[model samples]
Target: MADHVRTVLGPVAPDALGRTSIHEHLLTLLDHVAYTPVETPEGRELGEQPVSLATRWYVRQQWVGVRDNLRLDSEAVATAEVARFRAAGGGAIADPTTDGIARDPAALARISRATGVHVVMGAGYYVHRSHPEWLEAASEEEIAERIVRDLQEGAAGTPVRAGFIGEVGCSWPMTDRERKSLRAAGRAQRATGAPLMVHPGRHPDAPAEIVRELDAVGADLSRTTIAHTERTLPSPAAIVELARTGVRPSIDCFGLETAYYPLAPFVRMPNDGGRLAIVEALLDAGLGERTLIAQDICQKHRLTAYGGHGYDHLIRDIPVMLEAAGRGDAVEQLLVANPAAWLAW
Candidate 1:
């Protein structure tokens, strides 16, 4: 009578989803979209130094460059990462790397098998910059059909189909093609009842714009997640307003404490404590059921293999923080039940 949560290991009852991390990237090529934080509303100068110098010194090393942000292809590494999550009592992970960003469904299936953790792959296009050569020429119907096929059939010739439509990347001022892709993703979500997780550009207001556009196309906001709100929607009130609209405001990006814009002229990254505070605020606002969290581990630097905080951050760190903040029950709803319900039909 109830919908199952489709995973790489096959569909399972929603209760079967234990502690779930609603967003992540187990594998990906760094070519999806070039994020220019300086161009964002949050961007600011590092100091008196010119932005060009800060851009050249820091941004180039951190976020840009294909080699630095190259594809994380080691199954052994992914296995180790997933193992940490599992050991920390993690139940499942949703990998939202779509077409443009280098999605490997078969490999994801292999990782799921290797680690025995449920994996959900994302379908649909990323930002227009890294889109396939034919995406611009393709009709919205054609794009939607491709994504639907990926969700229902298989992605990249693998029998393993995607369980979700996105972490569909969109910029602040949405592009024409980006809007088209969002609409197509909405069409696929309507067809599959799978959630659409979006990566709104690094601005607090970006989520509202994205929701407005997605709503215009008749998307089920309850089935949509506006991601990276830890950085985008700075205040709990801002996030609560978005969640009140019926869409989930995902407070992903845990343990990534490095100020993304290390220097002036780039948007900054908040620490984990700040994120926990926001979580407390959301719970206080009584929107705990409408929110979720994840690591958004996209780079080697974010992985344990590279001496970073692995998948255990949220599972290990947050519960203490949550209970200390007095919302212990909120953790279960955010990481487990909310993800299952959002991903299920």
Candidate 2:
């Protein structure tokens, strides 16, 4: 690991991390989601539907209470949220809120102190949709300099170097600008010796190509993880190939079914099973040690009335699913061993 980076959880020596969710947004401002408009006419129409009085009242109450109380800028609230996670038995959480979306590093430090939970913060820029326009015009070397600065100098001037590289990639097809940004991100990773956590494109090949790109830039694949792979149902062979090459393939999406509530008019159940099937197949392929699971739960509404899925889900529900699948040890690997090793850098 580089001198600038420090794990908020202190030393994540082997077996020190217990129950970690590698991909999650602890406190997103919801600004990024706003940039990507609904493309289809029907989608836009649905989005514009007038809120029912009941729904309106609910939204208002949530906004007044939870949303207002949990703003990432508030150090006190961030500390409280970390306490909540610890109370629920979580040991560590990787907050992949990078660059523009990421908030104060001092706030993270305070939260770590208050809650006694290890927090690994991120250092790269976000995708094109979320990034500022100036970023798109910058040269790869310039972008790489910014990322390196974050890792070398603590983010927002905090003393801790960012513990990880991304949520760097985006969901859309890789554009020339995105490719340039990725190359820059890779260069930063190489310079800092920090692991890269990519937000792979929605396609399966996206991760494979990303790994290749990182390798070309001389980044260490053994320390990198391709995240949000839940949508990319890559073949088991392909997944194994990534693992063999030293990249950890993260299937982080777990409880996002609510996002598709009421379902699109054309979508159906069989397709819903696709994500779960990928999880099963990956486990069957013996990729358990290289896999990490998380809810990627970010929206303010997804958290309980008090706070987001809080922490009980990881301590309880996830273990139940693992047991049911006859892969109980796999859960330990993800929540404990894998993160410790990967984050140890």
Candidate 3:
């Protein structure tokens, strides 16, 4: 058996994990379902919800796409979706919803067993807003020790150990709390030998700052992946610069093409076509081997159950896209070899 990756089902050889989705959310429970819909990319109505129960129910019903649309709680639904990925020849997924997002390790284990997809769970706290109150009082060493336990033992008092250290949440102008989490995550990464996946705040400069902080903590750059460059850093040159640092830059938003979030001024969301141009730039910069890709499917609209492009969108569509663009040779590295190398222990 391959010892490169430890799936929820158990350890597997690297070659067994064919066409892995490096960063995705097979399940996400944002503290028992909560979200404030933005009227526009500017988030014009930035206020608190009414305290009345009737108004809360009314908001949830009215804002279907914006609110209460993220709860992927049905195991049967999740199982069917993973079956779709398997039908498309996908063999694994890296689910990065950690404590802040109600990560269900047991559910992940069930889904992996039912669907036969190698599911790799993540370990670490998320963004400042998603952190549990106890995390604020915990020291960096304490948090790092907890992650080590999650990796070496199991997570959420279950027997499913995490295979990676992220997607550690960070925003533009990293907060002190996020910085502390990053330091703790870096230390845990060193201790456990699991690769790190990062979610940079939707800013072009956020990844660079993340690299600086992780470096200060003695984290290995080569084992770190900066995710969502397609949404955050729109500039190919900027993506290339991060790749040059010996860190992997994940252009993982393959099918997402919207400006629904309030990130217009900071980032103009790119479609798959636009992301292709960025990938071309990385290849030209001789950083192809350091790049990774995924769909980052956190919302309901992005899933096949909801009519959006499923997890197989990239695996099925990108090859035709690459062959049409004269970049067919780049497919294997992005889809197979790189993820296998990055995810392997």
Candidate 4:
């Protein structure tokens, strides 16, 4: 039965999932026009000098390549990325670039074939602001049916359906539209038995609200992951509480702290040690098995430069951090055994 919902790489073998980055993006070209280009006079006036120069150069290049290569060659790029990951002894990645911006499954299959990395795709709407207009009018049951169909059938006409439920439903203050989407997503999780992943809002109260909403809808907390909980300063007690209810807390937004900037470095989680400290605290509190970690690096420009960290960081750095902090065994449990048990693959 799981075959219907699994990717081309069915029942990912233990050996296959060498080191997984469970939440990341394979392709994204966010509406760059929504904000002024970094090079524009208005951007310059705002003192975003570095960004302005970068944006101007990016836009110029995009224009020049508009006719030749407007859209990203996702298959080729993903294949190459997977090759690099494999070379680094990495195994699997979950491309949580759900609807609106996610690339085609055919592309995913191509990359999987070329590079031998297990690629898990996602199904569900993005943030409320980015969602398609029709979703505003759709019924919860209708949304659930759509999500179930994607899990049961496949995304983008492939025989392989998506393996998970999100990167879904975000709003700074948990807006009505996002709430509706969350309810629908919960309904989908209930129907498909797929793990529901969330992109929680930036507010501190966001994690509690998300867990509450999912609980209210009869979603299996055990199978749910609150992704990027690292963004908000969630109380250690709050994280433990969620874990007590069987939900997994994830600090999946590694290495891309630059995206959150000034707000992130300051948003420490109640203790003195920063985000990593919080994970340690969660482990100490008896919820280590319910924790997961990843680097949610997205964006074409970032990957095109600097070799992009490749996805082997978890297998490489996690043990070192844990050992340095005197918790080596905990690292093995969290990074390896925990993810396997949670996904039930």
| Per-prediction TM-score | 0.88, 0.79, 0.90, 0.82
User: What does candidate 2 score in Cα RMSD to the true structure?
Assistant: 5.1
Error of 2 at 260 (Å): 3.1
The better candidate by lDDT, 2 or 4, is 4
Worst 10 residues of 2 by lDDT: 263-272
lDDT of 3 by residue, 62-137 (tens): 3332443556566787888888998998989999989878799999999998888899999998788888788888
Worst 10 residues of 1 by lDDT: 45-54
Poorest 10 consecutive residues of model 3 by lDDT? 42-51
C-alpha lDDT values of all predictions = 0.78, 0.64, 0.81, 0.66
Backbone clashes in model 2, listed as residue pairs: 19-335, 303-308
Any idea what lDDT model 2 has? 0.64
Ranking by TM-score: 3, 1, 4, 2
Report the number of the highest-TM-score candidate.
3
Q: Local error of candidate 3 at 16, Å?
A: 0.6
TM-score for candidate 2, residues paired by index: 0.79
- The runs of at least 3 residues in candidate 2 whose Cα sits more than 4 Å from the true structure, single-residue gaps closed, are 1-5, 8-14, 35-81, 234-245, 259-277, 306-308
Among all candidates shown, the one with the greatest lDDT: 3
Please give, for residues 147-233, the per-residue lDDT of candidate 4 as tens digits. Answer: 788777877666777888887767778878788888888988987678889888878778778888988999988889988776664
C-alpha positional error of residue 318 in candidate 1 after TM-score superposition, expressed in Å: 1.2
Model 1 agreement with the true structure over 1-345: per-residue lDDT tens digits? 578777987888888879888887898876335433344433433321222432334433444432344456677888889989998998899999888788888888888888888998899988768688887888888988998998888888888888888978787677888888888888788777778988887677788888888887778899999888867866777788888889888888787776664322256667888787777777788887887888888866667766677887888888888888777878788878888888887
